[model samples]
Target chain A: MSDSLFENLRLELRRGCLTLAVLANLRTERYGYTLRKALEEAGLEMDEGTLYPLLRRLEGQGLLASEWREENKRRKRFYRLTPDGERMFDHLAAELQRINASLERIIAEAHA
Target chain B: MTTLFERYLHAVGEALPKDVVAADVTAEIADDLHSRAEEREAELGRELTDEEAAAILREYGDPRVVAARYGRVQSLIGPELLPYYWSTLTLALVVVVALELVVGGISAIVRADGLRFFSALDVAVHSLVWVFTIVTVIFAAAERVPQGRQRLARVMRWDPRALAAPSALPPVARSSSLAEFIANTLALLVLLDARGAHRVPLDRLVATMLSDLHLTLTVAWQPALVGTAVGAALVAIAAMIAFLRPQAAVVHEMLRMLGSVVAIVGLAMTLASGPLFDPGGGIATTIGYVTLGAAIAVLAVQAVLSVRALLVRAPMPTPKSARG
Candidate 1:
């Protein structure tokens, strides 16, 4: 009901989904700003400030593989999802779809 | 001019760990800033000024706020330990206050000098400061230990079966009207004979010891004490009658009258009683105005109950829809 409380709860709900989204997009090589822009295109507005830190955390967790190479006359660390990340993503995607379908059914039954 | 881009990177670098890794981290951020500035210039079809770069950096937020995301989470005491911290502080404060009261009471009784107000207060303050400081330091240190949060969290884990079944509980009584009857009666007896305690008085021994400590009040209000006691008695009687004869309008008026007497007794006590001779000898106005303040609080609550009892005779407000 309160705006800040609603924001905090919404942030918590989105935390896991953001991680999954980030890992999924890393299936192809992309750098910090590019990954952020890609996520924005998918309708998730991530803070550019947080994007690099999240990238570092995911790489540290072994869910992402990264390397630096020169592009457009500047060097940038590019990231891609690891094999382990791919398997984790498939499992989470299945779980999310199952939950979504169940929730839709519940809403429909309530309306009926 | 130290450009805003340079200033921003310096701040980020300072927040980061002071090691070789810091260099690489700063380099990454500097590269990101340059790329963003170039993109903005391209969009505007011109080179951006230092102020424009500053605005972009400000939108990114404070360096420390952004850097905090990269650091391992740190707190002196986090939410997981907060409940235990509160319980410990509360328990410690209660025990310390109680110990000071007992020790000060004994010292005043033994010393012909009687209880000095400041001495007892000094002990209480010292005890609280020492105990509170020690407990906080211990918890803060414990919070720094590796895996400490997880270890503490595991200790408070919930089990589904541990909670009591709501349906299994015995039903509450329909009303609790007579709950204060016994308490009021005891207070009345104490008020009736403030001097009577000095007769057989183990309490009088304590009182004599207490009085011996030079902790006596400047003026005694014996009549006001008696009035408060009598008011308490009348209030108890009124409450009992109101409950037993809830439908009787006459009885409700009597309860209201009794509530007024209790309030007047409080006013009289406040007028007649003087300041305690030794303010720190713990609850200094033994048989007088100190009791009056407590009696005033009790009267206020009793007054509310009396008002409610009087209103019972009046018809309840009904919705217009119900009438229709």
Candidate 2:
């Protein structure tokens, strides 16, 4: 398969998990660069441009709260989910589970 | 020495809104680019130059595109507000055009020779109205867009709590006396100064007054004067009611309704006493009649909306115990 095709598949797979990945990782206070690294380490690759704005919007929607802190002579903005965000994350996780189960059933039937 | 990569970073930083995207984001992006370039240099066993780093940055696309992605996560205004904005704009345009035509017809009657003058004035006013309408529509749309919303939020330094707070209706009932005073003063001045009652000068005067006064005064003065002597009396009553309650939304509704009534009355008087006040009976007369009529209609609609808002009670908040 071509590299472009592989890259497209990777993007589609990552896009599916992006929201869940962000909510899960933000359980700990982390800035943009650290969050990106953590997601990559977990096998979900995201670009800097995509991560930063998603963080801001999630924060805006009251799902996340952020504060700027200085550490090791560097300024970093750390974000964490609010109580509302936690509740929403649980709801979304359940919805994603139902979706995954449905997809698994359909694939199993096709193989059968 | 500073490299071309540094120059590119600076340019992007300058283009973006300073408040939304932090300095650290720029620094991190620059650092990442430098690291990438170094990795490439090591792989090729050659030193990467400033130009090569700049080339890599360029391939990443314009800084604005990157910055915009950050802001475009969600819309501010969404599709809901579009209908209301369009309806308001269309109504305003129709009323203004209708007024211009009526004035043109009237002027054509009084002055047999100066049809061209009326036509020119009509074109000029129409052009101005179109320009203002377009600008307002663009502004309203941009405010809804994420990038525009971010810029506006930065400029306005908006308080999120203000959205959750109960709406405070203006104390219209208390301010009726003040409204009446302003209305009566303006109406008497217009009626007495019937000397220069032509449309062009009077319209200019009204615009100038609206621009200078506070919002409360502007809403009150025009309506009280135009509707009736009864409108002036309503203004006093509205002001008193507004003052006594201070918190009641109804006061504002009353004042707005009174103001619209006065404005309509004043317009009627101007039309009825026409050419008698200004015998020039040409382009000026036509312009005056149309402008006054349009102004009245606009004020009347606004007043009605204000009253409606006042009369409607906002829903009560759910008690904390009820949620459990």
Candidate closest to the true structure, highest DockQ: 1
Residue B185, model 2: lDDT of: 36
Model 1 chain A weakest 10-residue run by lDDT:
A48-57
lDDT of 1 by residue, B1-324 (tens): 137778787888788744326666666777777777888889999988778888789887899876666765556687778877766775677567545643553343334222332376478888989989987876776687787766766765768759433322122222432554456545544443344334333547657775676665343444455456445555555444444444333544565467456546655665555554456335555554455666566666766665665445434456799777
On the 0 to 100 scale, the lDDT of residue B238 in model 1 is 48
lDDT of each residue in B1-324, candidate 2, tens digit only: 146777667766776655666575576566556556766788989977767766777776788777666554344344644454454455455345434533543343234223433483467477657956674766576765667745644554547656543554644443464565566535533432322233445745754653453211222223223344334334533443444445544644666586566657766666665351223455545665687778777867877787777667667587999779
C-alpha RMSD of each candidate structure in angstroms? 13.6, 16.5
Candidate DockQ scores, in order: 0.51, 0.22
Reference interface contacts recovered per candidate = 0.60, 0.30
| Candidate 2, superposed: residue stretches over 4 Å from native | A1-17, A26-45, A59-88, A100-112, B70-78, B117-324
Off by over 4 Å in 1: A1-5, B17-20, B112-117, B126-130, B153-324
